[model samples]
Target: MVAVAAALALGTNAGAQLYSTPAEVTANPLVKGFTVSGLTLSQGQTRVTLDLAGGRLVGLLVQGQGAQEVARGLVLAWGGEEKNVADLARSLGAEEVKAQARTAQGFAEDSEGTVLRLKVTGSGNAERWSAYTSLLIHPDSAFPTTANAEGNSKAPNVLRVFSDFQCPYCKRMWDTAHRTWAAQPNVYRVVHYHFPLEQHENAEPAAIASECAAAQGKFWPYADQLFSRVEDWVPQPNPTAKFVEYARALKLNVGTFQKCLTSAAPRTAVRAQYAAGLKVDVRGTPSVYLNGVQMQDYSDAEEAALIRTVTAASPSAAQVIEARLKALR
Candidate 1:
């Protein structure tokens, strides 16, 4: 592990030090899961840093430049004030917007959560701007989690999908599984798992909020409301508000529901799911695995072929070999 010197926040007049390498930046205690380099903040100054090259913050990269252009754009975006960004901000919720903005252009850590000062550059004068932003990575305790859904007692070969409440692909997969389950009720069991992406800022919180409801014995009802109208909210600017509406639709004790959204344990469990996805190389939504064998695509025909191969201990095993040869050809 690369060692990090205690980093002073940006603008603090703390002693100058060399970061010198990428490994150092990655292992820094102050930095969470983001890239850092090519930027400087004086000691005691706060800023969030990100991997610009990674296309990680494409939404806020200012290809356009003007005096105070970035800062002004941020303020407008932050307050649901800017026409261009407001729709997105409102859809994503103000908190999510701030998270997106703070790390939009790498930020540095300080007494505050990761923060960054917006300044317009490229003009030799290094023109400074005033708009600032902060991104909060809730305490680890705030992530969402799952308590095994009770009826999962159906079978040992069950497959569970902890999916995002707002993801479009999740809906399609749910439908596909529903149809498949109806037909193959004895062959497979489907369980749901929640893995909300960070990019879908509201997703994690909403998932945690739902899981909290689940704790209170309302999870399936809440999930039904979310998935039922998921299509209506797709490509819309604010999926979170729609989720709140779904909560209201379910009459899920609004006060308790909101409290659940902010709860730490639920959030922590949600983050754990995201981390688990990363571990399994799940790059997108609707990823599924069968008995830990990731199911890329197995139609009924393919499944039947495998079942036949397994059940029939043919004396020749020759047909299977010939079939394999034909497939390779």
Candidate 2:
């Protein structure tokens, strides 16, 4: 059988608390799983260890006074039972959780404390149930954006791009952006927006999937895998199954990663992003906006010209306002 040793460390004013008792945490009797074996709690820090033998790993760190309290009582506290890994991941912390896939064990931290979920698909498909956790947990940073809340500060031209993981058009535009604007130091700024269609169930899942991976600071790698699967039809079984493969390929904590995807928070976040796109006039995937000016043709020449114009003008906030007003007229 596959064996996993999960460790978590908590910190506070008192110092660090370490939990490592194998008996305190129990593995799922039917299928391999994890439980808190030992716990160390203090006013400043808390720690727990999960002996995940034949189970997937998921984790989170909670900060702040409320999180500290939660961490103190987490081992004794019981949350709702969730079959999906994502739900279990989120239960640890009340934040949105999304699932990712990886081959091995992984860990995460937030406001509450640190958590480690392991994947113990030890020997057979039957043993994989260990990956589906009954416990709860809740689940960062990649790609610097030149655009601020008001829009591009350097480029002044905000390229809001609506993209899909399964769309070839989106891939083409992504490539073109890299060759054109993304290569420049501070020429043009691009803000990507996700708009996975209903026809492509996998596209939305993939978007959430990548976001879940982002929880572990692996957004780009997750994006790369999703984009790589653009040619194929990612459906319930296929996309879900393939995500596990991708996680395995990336050596991610398969259990915790998968749980993140099936959680509510990440799903809500994806939906919120999509709703925000509607307000910005995204009629279709691969939509482009240059300085708030929608680009009808995503051709190289048109995109390049727009880039050159914005870069040369280096429009100020007032100038950008004027330009946008002129377009309205």
Tens digits of per-residue lDDT, candidate 2, 193-306, equal 677877776788888877777677676566767776665535445577777788778888889898997898667767766776565546678876554444556565644453
Candidate 1 Cα lDDT to native: 0.44
The candidate that achieves the highest TM-score relative to the unseen native structure: 2
User: Which ranges of candidate 1 are over 4 A from the true structure?
Assistant: 1-145, 148-156, 182-187, 231-241, 298-301, 304-329
**For model 1, the run of ten residues with the poorest summed lDDT:** 1-10
Provide backbone clash counts, one per model: 35, 51
Model 2 lDDT on a 0 to 1 scale: 0.44
Displacement of residue 75 (Cα, Å) in model 1 is 57
Q: Write the per-residue lDDT of candidate 1 for residues 120-164, one digit (tens) a residue.
A: 333434433233332221221332235634333454344546578
User: Relative to the unseen true structure, what is the C-alpha lDDT of residue 140 in candidate 2, on a scale of 0 to 100?
Assistant: 6
lDDT of each: 0.44, 0.44
Model 1, position 254: C-alpha lDDT score: 76
